[model samples]
Target: MSKVYSTQELIEILAQERRSCMNGQRLNLAASVSGNPVIDRFLKPEGIQKFSAYNDFKAAVHSYQRQHQVSGIIWCELTMKGKTLRYPAIDEQLAALDSDLKILKAAKADLLEFWYTGIQGMDLYLSINFGKDYQKIMPNDVKEVAQKTEWANLYEYKNYNFWEIILQLGWGKPEEASYKRGWPKSGSEYIHAVNPGKCPIC
Candidate 1:
């Protein structure tokens, strides 16, 4: 006879497996900031003018890591008012970038994943696997789980990759018209149109 496990038990088991699989891969704590000067100004400290220098930003991130005991950081760039803006101040950006790199070095993890998205219609996606986690949770497995879940719809892009679908669908975007209605359990198979909001993964 086969052993039976309750839903909670199964969930716990999966969580444990995920944690073990994620071992040495680093945590997923990330920071997302808007590129708008107005937003940046609002976030600035009172009285002391000028946005915090990039060096300052690095120090702050380091401080945060020290206090929270988290791994490296994922930096995400966003647009303001539908217009894409270049990351100004290369020196500062590089400083923060270096700080993150140092964190990764200390943690002994591989490269950190950096992500940036243009206007609503323009998006980019990339998949990152660390340690042996990929073996347990493949892209197809994620698709299958998403198919079994429900979520909301936002928008769809022509180029849909595993990471892109995961991010957008996680945010409640509706699957594109071209997407199929089945979950892929393995990379060998394919899913047609997928419904974002209803994706079983997110």
Candidate 2:
């Protein structure tokens, strides 16, 4: 059976892997190896000798990862690009994510969910199916409200943020929406937000 891990759990696993990578930088090989051939192979003197002098083993490992495109995750399924569909549970979460993405899109943003998980914390704001369909989503009342007023802390409403965008440059808060009721607001703001240094490079 396949294991289902939460995103937070996966993040913790990644952090543990990072700590192990850091520890591997010391290259502390064991004094003795078990009789197992696999263990012996790795414990070979020549194998140790090759990496003995490289203090930055983590960097070398990262370089190897880059060279081979090894993402490390062992996916159980075979490759099936556009043919694959998300699980129902995953689809729900993705829809929620898309709702947040749409809010950011409304404000011309490059921000991700990491900045603000949701209005009341994580997964607290889930106003899925904003409108009748994907093509014409977002209620006219909310859109009209957004157009007339500059709403800040949108994530507080389980929406996304665009305070860092150029349209919001003069805006005091970093969580304000860049647009007021319409798309683009202006290409100039888009340009400023996308410039290398103006926005959060992180």
Question: lDDT of each model, Cα atoms only?
Answer: 0.30, 0.29
Query: Which has the greatest TM-score?
Result: 2
TM-score between candidate 1 and the true structure: 0.16
Error of 1 at 61 (Å): 38
Position 37, candidate 1: lDDT: 82
Q: Which stretches of candidate 1 lie over 4 Å from their true place?
A: 24-202
* lDDT (tens digit, per residue) of candidate 1 on 1-202: 6554433343344345444434522232232345678886666232122222322444544454445443333333333335432221112111123444344233211111111122223222222231112122334444554454332112222435432222322111111111322223211112222233222222
- Alpha carbon lDDT at 197, candidate 2: 23
What TM-score do all the candidates reach, one by one? 0.16, 0.20
lDDT of 2 by residue, 1-202 (tens): 6554543443354455546545554344543345788778768553453344232443444344344443322212111212321111111111112233334334422221212211111111112232111121222333332344321221111114422211111122121223322233311111111222222221
True-structure RMSD, every candidate: 21.6, 19.8
Error of 1 at 154 (Å): 15
The regions of model 2 sitting more than 4 angstroms off are: 25-202
